[model samples]
Each structure stands twice: as structure tokens, then as C-alpha cells.
Target: MNRKTLVLPAVIGLLAPVLAACGGTDGGSDGGGAIAVGTTDRFIATADAPAPLDPAYAYDVGSWNILRQTVQTLMIQPRGEGEPVPEAAESCTFTDTGNERYVCKLREGLKFADGNPVTAKDVKYSIDRALAIKADSGVSALLSTIDTVEAQGEREVVFHLKTADATFPYKLSTPVAGIVNPADYDKGKLRDGFEVSGSGPYKLEAKVENDEMVSAVFTKNADYKGALTVNNDKAEIRSFKDADAMDAALQNGDIDVMSRTLTPEQIKKLSIDPGENVELIDMPGLEIRYLAFNTDAPGVKDKAVRQAMAQVVNRSELVSKVYGSQAEPLYSLVPATITGHSNSFFNEYGDPSTDKAESLLAKADVTTPVKLTLHYTTDHYGAATKQEFEVLQKQLNASGLFDVTIKGTPWDSFVPAQRKGSYEVWGMGWFPDFPDADNYLAPFLDDDNFLKSPYANSVIRNTLIPASRREPDRGSAATSLTEIQDIVAEDVPVLPLWQGKQYVAARDDITGTAYVLNSSSTLQLWELGRGVSG
Candidate 1:
């Protein structure tokens, strides 16, 4: 994919990947029938919970991959563009100078796959219903700033914000903003079962599930009205329990393309010497991994204790031994790609040093050999996690400053463990809801934070965040953003570990794998086709 420097409406810097330019000079790929894609990602809440296809309840990559193809948002990031272009709407903008009031006018003749009219009222219902349900596992926190949404006539929709938020436009481009048919979705509950009625290029033709989503079949919707181009007539998405199965599926020609949850070894193999018919496509990755501390937990509650542990963990060594070439060391909350990125952790804690850690603990009068448990998910993150945590245990134990125990839990249970405070410190990861400095910092700082932390700083929560959000030009807010990182480094609520590099492995003949992810990193299945691009 060709990289383009795009300055978004908020004036933040982005290295957007141009899929259109790389697809072909004439633009787009040759006509194809259907493409089968495979992954080892989990989408549903559980076997007994709501349907994984419901946009209102879905939050993970597996769910978003399907939702982004079938559902249409008010605005969308065009192929490789950082800023959003109108999709369901003809145009959208902030009407007020304070950036508190936003307005959108619907596109003419828009209709859902079910042939239902796409109206402003349905838009209101979609957003309002999501907020009303407010599922703990849902995307409510992302839209917490929205105070209310109202429909004006049949074409216009107005969003009233609780406070100034200049980056609201980027948030609208995410899959959580995906619109659904009001007649099908519940008002204050998640719609169970796999049927989906959307307005995007494809409809969920059939969805199969056993314990989790097994497979889903999507076919292009003739009634669909949107800005996206449908290159293939149909797309089949398959799920696997492990990377080995997905990798074998790709190798055996059972699946056309495989992504997400590819092991580091598999990535290395595909990157170096792919099979005769295989190809590797690399894209900029914003996914980051870190360890979040339960600030109230014993042995890790002290600021000095957290800082001492941070001083000893070598990020470079961790990534090298655990992730290999697939990841790089991360030193701050915001990724290096976004504006206002800082290496606060590196600046504060230079290299792995036991002397420094020992001194800090001594000054704080902390007891030696602090007992701690490091928790990681056995299934959700991938096979590398158990080894990653074991390496972490070795590093901490070698310092002789802590007695560590490593524990593994399945994702379905790991989520509940965090809520129950089952672990003192645990592995957590984030692929920004949208690419912005605010997206990285705001969620953790706010009261509705996903951090599950007792750590609080008034300056970060009350001052720096609000000040940054008030600035219309996000780049100008760099001072505040950097200050937030600096403060986080000092506090050590979460210790940054590593940032992943994105790679997509596919057969050489498959087209638009480079174009699959838009500016926001949501998979656009319509971009995929059988033959090479024109």
C-alpha cells in the first residue's frame, strides 16, 4: 500500500495508507465471485448473550470486521483517507464555534438491505438505543460525550455534546456508530441471534454459531445505498480457535485471505519466503499492549512500588524475545504515528536497572521481595501471551525485588476477573477507537474509564483532557497531550510494553488486501476481489 500524509479536519498528522493508488492505475480490482477470509478472533460476548452481529453490543475486532462491511455510519473514512467523507449523510459538520453542536444531512434515496427507508429518526434511534443499553462490554464509553441526538425533518440529524470535543468526527467513522434498522434492533437491549439488517454494501446472508461465531456468509445487497464500492459479489468469513488452523487454511487454499491472530513465527515465515502463490502486505499498526495495575491491590498500591517495577522491565527485551519482528517497544500511551507522541517512559526510566529500582523501594520504605501475580488471557490474545508473561515473570524474579506468579485465564473469564479484582496486575491491549492522542488518553482518565483503576489525578482528569479537547486544531493541543503522558509516566497506572506492526497474508492473486482497512483500521470487505487490480 502507498503511504500518504493526510491532515484530518482536526489538523492532526496521519500516515494514511492509499489502497486506491495501489489497487490499480485505473482504480479497483477485477471482478470476482466470493472471497473467503479467516481469523482466530472472538466476536460474541458468550454463548448465552446477545448476537455477535449487533453493532450496539459488539466491541472487538471480530465483530467490527463484520459490522463495518454490513452497516453504514453517518460518515466514513474513504480508502486511505484520515478524515471522514460522508457515507449515509450528504454532509456533516460542527455548526457551533465551540464544537459542541454537530449536524448531518442524510443522503438522498438511502435504504437498508431490507428495503426500509434510512431516515434521520432511525439514526437517532440507533445512537440513543446504544447509549440507553449502555452494556459494560459495549461501546458506550466512546460516545459518552454525546448528550442527546435529535432528528430534524426526515433528512437531518443533530447531535448535542456535553462538552467541546473537536475529534468527534473521527469517532463517527468507527464501527460502533454503525447504523442498524430500527425495526430490527431493540430499544434498550442487545438483539440476540445472527440476523443483521444494514445499509452498507453487504448483508449477513447466514451466520453460524456453536459456542462462538463459527462462520458468516455475506452477499452484496442490491438495495444498499452507500459510498463504498463492492468489488466482490459475496464474502465468506470463517473463524478458527487457533492460528495454526487459520494458517493451514490459508496454506491449503481453503481461505483466500487470513488476518488477525497470526503468530509471530507464522508472520516471519510469510514475510520472508511466502509460498509460490502467497503474498505479504504490511500496513502501519496502532495496536499497543500494556500492563494495567489495579491501584488498590496490595503490594502494588504504592506509587514507588509501581515505579520500581517499571524501572526493571526491559521493553526491548520483552518484544524481542516474545513478539520478535512482529512488534516494537512502546514507551507511551499514544502511538508514535499520531501527533503529540512522547517517550515519557523511556525518558524517566532509561534502561532496565535493579539499582534504581532498589533505591526507589528503599526510599519509599517498601518491603523487599514484593509478592505479585501477573495475569494474562490464555486464548484471546494469542499463543504468544503465555510465553510473554513467563518472560515477564523471569525478568521480575531475576531482579530479586519481587516474587512473581503467572496465571492464565480465557478471555471470557479474564474480563470478569478484571471487574472482580482477581489479579494485581494484568495484560491489557488497545487498538485506538480512532487514531488520535485524545483517544489514547481520555478513556483511561475519565470516570467512565476502562482502566478499572483507583488511580486518579485531578490535573489529568479535570484539566489536561478538557483543555486538549477544547482546541479545534488537535495538533496545537500537543502541549497538553505531552503533559498528560508525562504525568502518566510519573504515576505509572499502566506500564507500556509494546506496539504491534500490522501484516496481512494473502494469496498473490487476491486483490485489495492492501485496501481492506480504511483510515480508521476497520476492514472494508468490499475492497477484496479475486484477480489482480487493473
Candidate 2:
């Protein structure tokens, strides 16, 4: 879910598909290809979303991958497992206990890549423009709580929120809140093309071929005054279309690291034998995949129909058959790693019992062999997506209660079609915009959700979500969050499939590979370096 509408950000999360971009430096000794990353993510830019690199419109992980290095937000989610730390701002805190009015003091002499002074006005302008240009979707919804922003002199900016929200700081850590230069970007519309200008650890120059971003060289921004360390002088992020070529590039020493989407075959082989000079790095994952149905669709519109399908499908079988134990079966939209996670779906539909599925349909007066078309993207989620859908079709059809067919659409078309509720049922993968459980549930369940499905429960959206956001200690909101999961499990608008563990294949000489992908799914390129171990 991305630009033009709000669907992309919630569906796709903030990232496009893979690892971020940087410039070329060199080998283990420091000479070209220093941090060349090979990823299978193909960035699709439509007329509605022309600027994939602009912070005002870059919501997908692919664009966020570049934005994290090229731009700095008010706060930064540190490389590993710490809370978001200040980057552009020296220090920021809520001025009042209500969590509505917040204040941030800019660090002394912070400047954009162009060497222009970054003042309170720029911060105000960046936030204000993002709000004003809400004509299209970015991750602007994340910043929706911001009622107004006022710049007090050069070093200070004040934020007034619509309601109390403790998750505001975490939202600031995302690419949506990234600080931008006033001179380089348009205030009313999204900046066109892949070029980016921001004040972060790096200055990026991207290469685009036929509307797709191919390479972006990230040279260290000497004028950047942020908390992150710049390990490499230059870094290059190369996007590949083929997983085989990506693996070949990593093995052949043409690329230092490979991430985003790795094939199951590659993961299995790499785990067994990582070959000479290669290391397989697996991190705690914040990514999840699920099946969402359009609530108004003919075949699955009835809640009973949706519930029956959810009961028949077996998440354990799919994860094992596809990921080969690289993923865990998810019982809720919120992954287990997140706070307030629960096995609400499992508690309701424990086993893959055809009897349970048949009974549910019979009680609802839905005829036998309910026809359903499961839609998935061909190019976006990698090779396993097709097989995953095929397995899903087989599982449902074999149950004798449903007739399911799978359709694979290209990403560019799939996204547009999803916005129009073209698919009765479709598969989507979400990477959290922040670590909070609200991020996982709100985007799909809210009344103003990104999903075309009209799935809305006032208690969960207006009541439960606001309640969770009000609590300063996120852990204390467990009861409310757990209740949301239970409601979602009962409604069955979206079916939880499986949660994934992130994998990054890096050369032995690449330092900071472990810290590249943080819990928030933002790739921290500043952590990557050659010829050093961390």
C-alpha cells in the first residue's frame, strides 16, 4: 500500500521489497563494490506514485531503504534492539504529560546534503507540506495525529497532536517523518524521480532505467551531524530481478551482501553449507504474511464464509512446505515478537478440521463448493508466492466445502487492482513501520483502513486503538491489544498466515551485517563496512 491512496503503506508497510541503496567504494582493503547489495525487489512507480525516493511519497521498503541513509528523521531506530534515539534533533520530549504537545530542539548546525542550514522552519515546512500534500498517499497517515506544527526560532519546533499518542516517537523513527530540504523538494506535490536530498549519514545519487531504480550510490555526508556512524565512504545498492543472479553475485564476490527476498532453496543450501567466504545472517523478523478478503465480495462477503475458509486452511503446513522452517505459523496479524500478541485465531480454529468448516457453511446457509479466487502478486513477494497460493488452492478445494482458484498478478497491476477491491481474496505481506503491535493491527482493522474491505469495528478502531496509544508504557496496553486480535479473529476479514525470520547473506569481510536490518525493518547502511568485524 503506497501512493495515490493509503492502501500501499498498510499493505506493503513502508518498504517496497528489499535492501536499500548506496554508492560504490571497493574490496576488503577499501578500493570498489564495498557494500554492493543484490536484492530481487523491483520498484514499480505508477503515475500516482512517480517519486519513489521522495520522503513525501516513499512509503515502500524499497524506497525506505534509500531514504534511511539519504534522509534523517527527528528520531532514529538504532541499529539493534534499543528504543528510537534522536538523530536530526539533539533532544525531543513531550512538553506536557498528556502526550499531545511535544517539543524538539535541533542539534547545532545541522545541514542538508546541499549544505543549506536545517532550521526549525525546515522541520515545520517538511511536516506541514507532508500534511498539505495529502492529495496522495505516502505514509502520511502515520503523521495524522499531528494537528499542527510551530517553529519557535531556528533550533526549536513544537508539535500539537489531535489526541494523546505515546507511539508518536516510534512513528517519527519511520521514513514518513524523514526531514527534507525545502529548496530541493516541492511543497505542494511529490518530488519526481529517484533523486533524493536530505541531511543524513549519506548523500545519494540514483540511476534509473525505464522507470525502475537500478543503482544508487550513497557517499558519506561529511556535513551530516547525526548519531549514526558512517562506516563506508561510499556504498552501492543494486537491484536484481533474478534470485539466482543475486546468489551468484554474492558467491562471485560481485556483491558484498544480499537481502530483501532470498529463495527457499538458497536459504536451505546456505544454511547447510555457506560456501567459502560467505556467512548466512538470520535476524528476528518483523515481517508477516496474510490473506485478506474484501468484505463486500460476493463469494466471501458473509462472515461465516470467511470464518469457514480460515478454519480449513493450515498455516503450519504452508510454512513448512514453503519456507522449510524459516518461518513460524502466525495466529494473529500481530507477530509473536511484538508486544500484545496472542493466539486468537488458533484458539478459535485450532485444527484443520473439514467437519468444522462444513458445519460453519451449513449453518450460514452458504451452499457447498463456495467459489473463491485467491489473488497474489507474481513479481513482488518472490518465487514462493505462486507455490504458496497453489497450496492454498489445493487445501481449500480438497476440503470438499469450497472451490478455490489462484491467480497471480504482476505487482504494478496488483496494487492498483487491490485498491479497487478487485480480488475477492488476496495475499499480502506486512513489515512493521514501527515495533509496536498497533502498527500491525491498525492499518487493516481501522475504520479508515487501507484495505478496500469494509471491515470496521468501532470498539477496535475508535476505542481500543486510541486506548493503546494513550498508554505511555506500550506493554501495559496488552489487554486492549489482545482484545483487538480476538475481534479480528472473530470477524475474519484478514487471515493470518505465517510470520517470517529475516535472512541476510553477507561476505565474511562485511562488518555490521547483523545490524543492517533493525527490528523496524529499516536497513541501516551506516552499520555496514568492509575489512572490519563488529
CA displacement after TM-score superposition, residue 311 of candidate 1 (Å): 0.6
Clashing residue pairs for model 1: none
TM-score of each: 0.93, 0.92
Compared with the true structure, the alpha-carbon lDDT of candidate 2 equals 0.81
In angstroms, how far off is 141's CA in candidate 1?
1.5
Best by lDDT: 2
lDDT of 2 by residue, 1-534 (tens): 010100111222233222122222222334444578888877656785677677876666777888888888988775445456777888999989899998999999899988999999999998888778863443677888899999999999999999998989888888778888888878998888888888999888777788887887888899999766677888888888878889999889899888878888888888777777788887677789999989888898899999998899998899889987778999999999777999999999998899999999899999989988899988777889999999899999999998888899887788778877788899999888888898998878764466656777889978999999999888999999999999999999999999987888887777766567877666777777788432
Lowest summed lDDT over 10 consecutive residues: which window, candidate 2? 1-10
Cα lDDT tens digits for candidate 1, 1-534: 322212123211233334322322224453555688887876554654556668776776667888887889988765654666778888999999999999999999899998889999999999888888876663677788899999999999999999998888877877667788988888977888677788988888655555556787888889877666677778888888899999888888899888777788887777767675777676767788999998898779999989999999988899999888778898998888788899999999999999999999999999989999998988777899999999999999999999999999887778767866777899987877777899888777776676666788999988988889898887899999999999999999999899886667777667777667654455777888777522
